[model samples]
Target: MRIGLLTDGGYPYATGESRLWCDRLVRGLPQHEFDLFALSRSADQEQRGWVRLPDRIGRVRTAPLWAPHEEDTRHPGRTRRPQGRIATGLGRAYGRRDRRRFTAHVTALVESVCAGPEAGPGPGEPDRAADLFTAGLYGLAELAQERGGLHTALRSEATVRIVESACRAPGTGRTVHSATVPDYLAFAAGLERALRPLSLDWYDDDALGAVDLCHAASGGAAALPGLLAKRFFGVPLLVTEHGVPLRAHYLAVPETPLSAPVRALLANFHGLLASEVYRQAALVTPGNTHVRRWQERFGADRDKLRTVYPGMEAERFAAVGEGEDGGGPGTLVWIGRIEPAKDLIALLHAFAEVRRDEPGARLRIFGAPVQGGEGETYLARCRALVAQLFPEEGTDAQAAGDHPVTFEEIGGAEVPDLAQAYAAGGVVVLSSVVEGFPISLVEAMFCGRATVSTDVGAVVEVVGGTGLVVPPRNPRALADACLALLRDPERRARLGAAARARALELFTVEQNLAAFRGIYLDLVGQAPARWTAPPDARHPAGRPRPFATPPEAHVLGDLIREPAVPGAARVPSWAVGAEGVCAGARGAGDGDA
Candidate 1:
């Protein structure tokens, strides 16, 4: 089965949030062919280039949401009617009642955009154009909600009138006043770009129509394509959101210059979009419970929700604690991106107390900053803290090393791979003030090292009794936990052993692959049969079905393929479909339903 994998600002892009996890999933599941449809956030990200994809990936298509093309392309030559051409056309499309509403709404929205501070909408006059846009947009959204979807002839005069009415409505924000004729035109252009999926060219049989399932690597605009796939081709969409895009938008919009009304409108738009995505998705897989809760709040069904932790390769840490030359018994290593969120200030303060108590303790801070410009500032501050804490740097330095607190990059001296960072210490420490499932802690467990982690995000869930837990920002508590682990060699060994066992059992690539393998079959099995196109729907790089004939339809061809022969073949009749080949319809209800 061909899988349409959609992602926004991730996967394929070199700089992205979940690129690594997406890459791992695709590589681990080689039996399935994947087509990547990615949306890059910025031109800088696109210029940085993508990770080299494996041969199993069939095709790649990308678009940039950060910077859309400036040139406006109208829908060919059409006669201009009253209320300026666009409004009349929209009016006719939306019918009499909706026609007036959509025109008024869109006009106000366009005016607000034209009036934007960047365009000349000044700070005093909130961009009413934005509000107008919101009114028109949501009006259309409400229409879609009422009618199941927008009609194909939606760009008529009625639509424009509905938009125009919304812009000129009373009690509306003042930003609408700043919207000039050109601003409205420009706003309309931007809206079209954002709503491009509504009129995408890929929904036909040649594209998503042939796929067995559409798996959105992440939601929001990345999933928009999948939404279109389901809408146009009847394909089932499986949306996987590791980090909720709506939450990110909430975090980001406050920093923008848009008026409160504009912000609220945009937020509502995103909220509505999220709800729609959840509604259309066959299943929603959130990487952790935090994300799962976010989905539920946005109205996703609990039954449709599944939490699948992103898997990591754990074999690299196989030699730790369980081996003869493992780490010394009293070191604590903090490994991960050196961002302020990692709370290095808190870690430094906690380490000071840990040092005073142990007298011979060492903390190895490994990892470079992931954020580009601001990272250097955080790194400098952390280094200064370390210098102040252990001012000298000899046996007066703290431990036996050149520096009691060493900050080194992975692939540098002392630390080579991530596994080596964990192995350098008997106890791994995480003093993050904020985090998302500390991947470093999981690596430490894989290395058979005990850990002391602050309670935040999925730290408690992931650690699962395998490590000591402490409150974030409490320096004394962190120190006490570290001291307890450092003082007990037996307890450390036991916890480390258990952590490794747990990691082996739950977090390995093998287990992740197994879970997804089952999920893929289960989801597709329950999905409605959507692929109704003829065999010509196949892509140029298609695979042939070797055993498409049913057992009842064939005599010589399937005679040898009947029941069970012996040994492994006789072990189970239900396991025959494990290879994803064409199976008989004796139990085809699973996929057909």
Candidate 2:
């Protein structure tokens, strides 16, 4: 099968979210061919280049999602026009009629976004606003497909005017009505970028249209191309979300400098986009139940939702797990990117309490701060808190000294790697206030270390009775859980063993690959065959078929040959029934037959 793997700022890239799992999936499944359609978020990301691809990956097509410069107008894959016929500016891209159509569509879209959920009438009447948004969205996509692209139209002054009008329109939200000219302009630019996938050349028959299935690695912008492919070529879309994009957008809105109105508008757009993606997708695979609930609340059909846990390479931690001795029984380890969401403040406070109870207990924090200044700022704050909490212990912020609390990274002298880091602690702790999938917790599980994590995101689901779970933001509960694990070596060892068993059963790359392999076959089996004979061919074109030809059918020799056995009775091919042949193909022995 030919799979079009759609991704944004990830997969095929050397660094990004969802890269490892995607790489693992592709490598594990060598039977299916893959065509990667990646949307790079920044110039730096693209410059870093892609990871080493497998032999099965047939083609790689990438486009920049970042703001394009003047030179980018004539980027490769853009449809060529006659020299004199080319558009020179935003205004010249459309005629008077096209401009009117664009105005109507953009107005409808913005108006729908501006009007809050309350705009929808009671049950019987349906949500007119939602219908308008969907119509406007697809209408713009169709226009972009017919015209060269919507880049010019979406970024034009007319679009700003449409947004402004929608903001000021009667019955719109109060926040939306407060939108200034600058806000309108900002939103117009953002909208243009968000909808940029509509103008991509990937929809052509030779690109996404040629693939058997469109698998979106994550939702939002990544899945936009898959939506277009499904709309254009009847391709089935499979959307997988490790972290819900809408939830991320909501969390990030306050962090941006944009006005409330602009933020609100963008949020609405993302919410609508997520709904559409969910509605259109043949299947929506959320990484955990936490993500699944978000999808369900956003309009994904429960029947279509499947929870597929992210696959990890358990082999790396195998040595650590199988070792006789676990790490120091009194030590608690915290691993993950140092960010505010991880709530290191709470963890530090909780550790202070732990110190009061058990003076010999040590806390090792092993991770580097994430990309922004925020992480550095949070790390500084945490360090300050640590000093204040353990003033009498003589702490060293960079290394483990006589102090009970130590801040360190994974690659330093003591902790050489991830496995070793987990091996250095008896109890792995996750104090994140917000999380999608607790990857660090899973890693600790693979390392055969008991965990005490805050009950957030998929923590409880991932832990699954193997480890202790505490309420988020509760220093007392967190401290108690850690103490419970630290005080009882028997319980810790038992939980560690159970965690390793669960991790081995549910979270390995082998199980993940098998799940997807089966899903791909099932989806393809249900879908009608897309193959058609050419007009000049011997067979009639567009003849309906029951199912697409399986890849195994192309092999020259018999797929299943019965092994010969001494004194075994050979059944004549004509005498054998269809069920007998099927049973034989399923490895039924000659004696059983």
Candidate 3:
């Protein structure tokens, strides 16, 4: 089957949240063809370039999500229109009718977003605000397709005025009611960027329309193209959210410098968009139950949700897991990106306590800060805290002589690689106060190492009963859990064995690939076959059908005839009855079967 893999700020890129998993998925399932529709987040990311793509990738189409520039919209084989110039033909400048439509749709959209909870529909009743949001969103998309792009209109003074009127509308929330001109302008610009997919040329028959299934790697703007594909061409959409976009937005909005009114408006827009995506999707796959619950809370159908765990390479850790030696018995290892959310401070405190009890015990932190000044600053703080905690031991925290805590990256001579880093310790620790999935914990499990992790996100879910869990931000509990495993080798060995068994059973590249392969077939099988034809043509064009008939249909067609030999056994009565049905199905078209 041909799959349209839609991603935002990820995939094919050298660096992205979804890059590794997406690359794994594409490479693992070489039987299917994938066309990547990526939205680049910045020029820097685009310049960093893409990861080595596999042969199964048919095409890579990218567009920028950054500010408007001369080179932003340039795609190979497509004419490049100047940043503010409206093109002729299908992309012609909006007429008076188009302007009116844009105003009506934008007004409805902003009003719905501004409405308070008390004004929304309740219980099993249809959500009036949600309905308005959906209608206005698709209405604008339709307008963009008909009258070039919404770029100019979305940033026009009329659009800002519409937003202002919506904020002042009756029953609107207090936060939005205080929106000023600057806030309105900010929201308008953001909305335009979010809705830019509607103006993309990828929706035509030569692109998204030809794909058998549109598989969105995540929700929010990433899924916008898939939503449009389903809307315009009857293509089925499958949405996978490793991290729920609405949940991320809620967490990130506070960190931004935007005013309260802009924050609230953007939050509402994302919430409404997420709900619509869930509502229209043929299936929604969340990476874990943590994310599944978020999707459920946001209006995803319970029956449509599936929990697909992120897959990891088990072979890399196979040696460590199977080896007789389980590294230093007194060593505790911490792995993952260094950030405030990881709660390294709590881990350091717990380790300090651990040192008071076990003098020879050592802690090896294996990772660098994430790509930002904040991460660098946090790493510095962690180092300063380590020095203060172990003043008598040594001044340099990087050295492992007397100081118990040593911060190291993966590529050092002693560690060399990720597997070796896990192999260098007896116990792996995760101290994140906020997490979506405990990837580091899973990696530890893959290495057959006993883990002591703070309970957050999917830690308990991923670890099952194999590892010890403690409440986050509790130094005493974290220390106790670590001491329990450190003091008893047999228990640690048992837990490590069990953890490896679980990881092997549930979290591997092979299992992930198999699950998605089946899911793709199942979704396509249930959806009605879509056939495209030219407007002036008398007959529809021939194309490969996906899951059009049962596997038995093909075999049964040849078996329908009478026995050639007189003594040969005749076909069953049931087989004879299916001959006409199978023959008729064979004439329809050849499917992926």
Candidate 4:
């Protein structure tokens, strides 16, 4: 089976999120062909280049979200000649409309894009403004549809006017405020880039359309391409959102200089996109219930949602779990990116309280700062707080020195590997005030170490019945939990064993592969067949393909030729390349091209 793996600012990139897991997944399922559709978030990220690709990966198509591309075509002035009453009517009201009118127009505009331009709203028609909107929409859509993605021209003025008109129109939800001219222009450009999937060439006969399934590695912009793939083609979509992208955006952009109105507009835009992505997906997989709840709140169908924990490699920790416990009886260890969101301040205060109860207790913090301006400040703050908690560690002005609490990075000669870092402590800890999947805790579990973590994100869920969890921001409670674990070595050992068992059972690569394999068969069994060729005809040895879902497995019972569903449009019908393979994945697998 050919799989279209869509990602944004991740995967294939050596220094980005999701690169590891994506690489693991690609390597794990060697039988399936994979294509990478990636969006680079920065110039530096592009310069960093990609991780090496495996043989099964067919091709990679990338575009930049950080840079803008110049469109070759431009409109001389705002107005264009209209040929018909429809174009004229649309033009007059293009500035504003009632909710009903807005929906009708937006629906029509989207439909026009769906139908190949030859059958689209004609040139120079009365609704020329509307026609222009539709044309540009489809034109950009056509560009993405024909090429891979849009970058330069998506920021054009034509796109902005359309979004502006829609927002001001009568029926948009109250949340969508009328964007100012500048805000409108900025948002329109951003929206075009965000919605570039609408114009991607992935729907061609040789692309996503040929894939047996489209698996989105993460949600938000990463899933946009999958949404389009399902829309233009009947390709089934499997969306996996480990971390809620909407929430990430909310937390991340609050400090940006964007105006309130623009922020509100962007929020609504992502919300709507999430809703639509959830609504159209054949299956929605959230990494944990915390994220699942967010999906539910956003209108994802409960029946369609599933929880799939990310698989973490456990073999690396095997030796540590079997070796002598490196953690002192009362030691505490915190591992993760040194970001402010982790609430190192709270952890320091908690450790101070812990020290009061057990004078010998020590806290060791591991990990490096994230690559951002704020990270430096956060790191400095953490270092300062460490000095205050453990005075012997040195003063604020002192360079890092030996102390009760230590801040160290992995790959240091002393801590050569991650497992050794976990083994360095008797008790693992997670003090994050904000978190996603709690990967460090899982790693701790794999090392057979008991943990004390704040109740944030999926910490409690991942800890299950094994580790001690305390409410976030409560130093008293955290101190008490740490003290309890410290005083009871027997309890710690038992919990550590259970945690190791749990990690090995539910969070291993084998479990992830098995779950996805079953889901594939289930999805194919339910939907009517889209297109199929005899297995014998495709492979030389006629070795039965193990991954291809048989025609009878389509979940929708059978393919139904229904009119295009608005907002739920998928990949173009022609996206599947000849030989029933996605061109990118098939070609890329031979070796990176």
Residue 22 lDDT in model 2?
89
Q: In terms of lDDT, which candidate is stronger, 2 or 3? A: 3
**TM-score per model over all chains:** 0.73, 0.88, 0.89, 0.77
Q: Compared with the true structure, what per-residue lDDT tens digits does model 1 show for residues 1-593?
A: 56888888899888877888888888888767787777776656777888999876886766655433332123234321211011112322446766555555555544443333333246587544344544555555444444333333244444344334544566444655444444334334435545544433345565666566789987778887787677665678999886778888887778776555445445555665677689789999888887888899876999999888888887677755454224467677888887888898998899899888887887888888866777889998988788777776744443445576877777966667777777787888999887766788888888888889999877888889989999999999999999998998889889988998887877777777787777777766566533242334322333222123231121121112333444434222333454433333323111211
lDDT of 3 by residue, 9-113 (tens): 899888776999999998988767788888877767877889999988987788777754335444644444322222222224557787778888998888888
C-alpha local distance difference test of each model: 0.67, 0.81, 0.82, 0.69
lDDT of 1: 0.67
lDDT of 4 at 312: 85
Clashes of 4: 62
Is 2 or 4 the stronger prediction by lDDT?
A: 2
Top model number, lDDT: 3
Model 4: per-residue Cα lDDT over 1-593, one tens digit each: 56788888888888878788888888987766688878777656777878989988886777655533332123433332211111012222233323234344444443322221233235554432334334444444543444334443335455566656765666454445445788777665656556655644456546766566788887878887777677665677888888999899888677978766567666655765676678778999898899999999876999999998888888888898735468677788888888888988888898899988898887888888988788888999877777666675455424453466778887987788889899988898888888989999999999999999999999888999999999998988988999999999899999999999989988988788777767865774465434433324423332222223343221211122223676564432233334343333422112111
**In model 4, which regions exceed 4 Å deviation?**
70-179, 390-402, 531-593
Q: Which TM-score value belongs to model 1?
A: 0.73
Alpha-carbon RMSD of each model: 10.7, 7.7, 5.6, 11.4
Task: Provide the lDDT at 221 for model 2.
Answer: 96
lDDT tens string, model 2, 222-305? 999899888887789999999998999999899899999999999988988898899999999999999999999878999998
Q: After superposing candidate 3, which stretches have Cα over 4 Å from the reference?
A: 70-92, 116-118, 322-327, 396-400, 535-593
lDDT of 2: 0.81
Compare the candidates by TM-score and give the number of the best one.
3
